[model samples]
Target: NDLRMHFVEHSTPSKKNIPVVLCHGFPHTWFSWHRQLPALSNAGCKVLAPDMRGMGETSVPKDISAYDVDTICRDLTGLLDYLEIDKAVFVGLDFGAFAIYDLALRFPERVIAVIGLENPAAPHNPNKPPLAEYREMGADHFLHINYFCEKVGRADDDLLVRIDEFFPKVFWALSGEGNYFDTFKFPKETHYIDALNDPPSLPWNWLNIEEMQVFIESYRKSGFTGGLNWYRSMDIKWEQRKPYENVSSNIPAYFLGSENDVDLKGFHGDDPISLLRKQFPNLRAVEMVSSAGHLVQLEKSEEVNTALVRFIDDIREEL
Candidate 1:
């Protein structure tokens, strides 16, 4: 577990307000928050965007057990200690969102508040382990969760070898215009590559050619094992979280997402926001951008920026 993390940091002059740490989700690096770094830092808040765990410039560990939530949260807490940061406002999306929420729960003393974009609470179901449900969900259709849990390198080889076909289609599939769930219609026998089709040539309204290539080239170099390892660790995380099954956090919280966000629409169960409110009584705002998708931050940068500034401001004022 020898690791080195790369992060983008913006210093703030405010003494009362704490720093803000931006965490990116799967298949993404710190560059995922390129839009937010300037905006949030411009608002007089310190910002740190890290290439979490195995993605981007960060070190990627081959061991599947290393990606568990305890170790992931420990990394963040360790970062805070290294920076001499007493506490900070943590904001995240997708896997990033789950990381920060777990951070708040595990090290409540080190977090001023948390803002989650596109994902609400940690994925939990007290009744049964999550993969059981994910497997059940994928029984009749092709579900990425169940698909990812394949014997070590199955999806990895299918995706990495077909890198040309994977990124654009997956990006578009999770966007407002495309349907991620459509891949589910493919029969179980289909490989992940065949199940995904080509997206209408890049340069969409949200992402440009250069922007998309950054992800493509980076993933190409990194091999995506580290990122996929996050998915591989889910069932393990579920089992480890038994002690916290009924635990809830009252740390101030907020959410930002796209109205058509695939995670909200499919994964988080119905009434996810209501579940959020119950988990965090001080939950303030749940901003959903219209006509946006899973990559809501980049898809509608302006809207996400406005909500982020206000959310950070509210938390800062309280500090």
Candidate 2:
């Protein structure tokens, strides 16, 4: 893919434990796992949180096809190769979860196990192309992914200029305290800003204004193009996975979800965990943190850390 990746790495004193890689999803970066970084390190594991694909300090590709899942998995597996790590347990949040899941499916020998947060599996429907369905969903109402897909430069234009306004609302909107689905109340033609529910003035519990600026500053320079590319390549990713529609992965897997996260509520059908299990037959733990949203890692850091540490402990023998 010829992409330059930037990552934050921490090695435990012994450096004998299996390494851990953290992958972030759209509108997020490696820093998104700030709280979990030390927790994992203190748990006697080496941690590597790479700014996946197009987000953060990583090189952003102009070609949309570059963001497809296959390329993304190549980036991860290649990362492991370069680091001389034969295998590492992967922890992923949001779309990042899909990246690790795909990596495991394609390169199972390279993955020790997987710890998925928020998004449980690589989202796909064998019946129809993903973009077509998103377009259909956006036909009558505002769907953020569809906006990112169809609007093209327009979505980037609107969001890049509104980076300041977008973060707070979008952050709050995706939080357990916020209702992301409420944005659908907006008309089809609505701009993303107007559609977002106004968040309570900054420092709303889980995130403070200072913490929010980290995102604002990063996105202000990076723009939304790279992240949005993930949405645009939805159909490309779907087509790439056509052969494994009914296949199951035996990789050791664990899931951490939130009760109110939008992805949990409706996006992946009624039972995403059950659906995830169908794909990862060796699935071990399923923990759903209460009072958390899509950003469960940030909202419930303690719980998320506990689950991650326990998962690593449970799999230490394998490592």
Candidate 3:
């Protein structure tokens, strides 16, 4: 399964400035970072944001194995190779954050530093059970992980059939004031669509109509399978990561999250920044953007941009 990634690049006046690679998570594309591109470029930093293997304009592989973490890292490293970039600072969100952590661990020399938004760095845990067992353990509940992995094509079909309706609710449900966690109170037999739409409000202020249309149109053309494949590959990634069980990323790292991020408590039920620091000793800073949510970069672009520029400047000075 060959995948050619599409990326947007912004260059600064100084060619010597280290490039920063931005990676978007599920149901997002390179366009997700548009707000920060100009700001980073104006700050004298070269920025490149790519639509990872199976999402956006990138080639989507039919085989689930191709979406594994190792393959995704290879796709990214290969992108750097194609661009003739020897090294770069990696910035990512959600699924992209997971990929950045993997890249930093597997190829530290190629990474100057890592900046993760929303998601934290999780070191390999040998004691943790396989994804399947974990899914079984949570079978009584309606977890997105269980739904996506178990249902697979059916899940994709359901979402795709109701793409327009599904995207808006999911996006809004994950936003700052969405109160998405409350959906969990529903019975375990509740359908994902029904549960996800709980307390759904119209006209998400965080994302404008134009922005919402862009996402809807993109998903309309590409379908959800490409993005869902990333979820399907989780078990394979777990099995493949066995060799790196004791490994931890030693690269310079920083994490930023929204103060209102639902996933912060909904998913892990722990302080992500604290867990991140425990996993990454060189983690330089942890900041939370007030009144922001899972999509912090877009929801609070100015704050995210300022923090990123500051981090870039500090790292550049150290170099």
Can you write out model 1's per-residue Cα lDDT over 163-199, one digit (the tens) per residue? 8778888888888888887788898767776777668
Instruction: Point out the higher-scoring one by lDDT: 1 or 2.
Output: 2
Structural similarity to truth (TM-score) of each candidate: 0.95, 0.97, 0.92
TM-score of 2: 0.97
Against the unseen true structure, what C-alpha lDDT does each candidate score? 0.85, 0.87, 0.81
Which residue pairs does candidate 3 place in steric collision? none
lDDT of 2 by residue, 1-319 (tens): 5879999997667857679999999889888999999999999888999998888999999889998878999899888988899999999888898888888888899899999998876457789998888778778888888777778899999998888899999988899998888888888778888899888998877888888999889888788899999888888889887876787889899998888898767678666787789889999999889999999888988999999999999999765
RMSD for each of the candidates: 1.6, 1.2, 2.1
State residue 62's C-alpha deviation in candidate 2, in Å: 0.9
Residue 290 shift from truth in candidate 1, angstroms: 0.5
Please write out the lDDT profile of model 3 over residues 189-261, one tens digit for every residue.
6657777864344456556778878887877778788898888887788877777656666688988888898
| Residue 182, candidate 1: alpha-carbon lDDT | 77
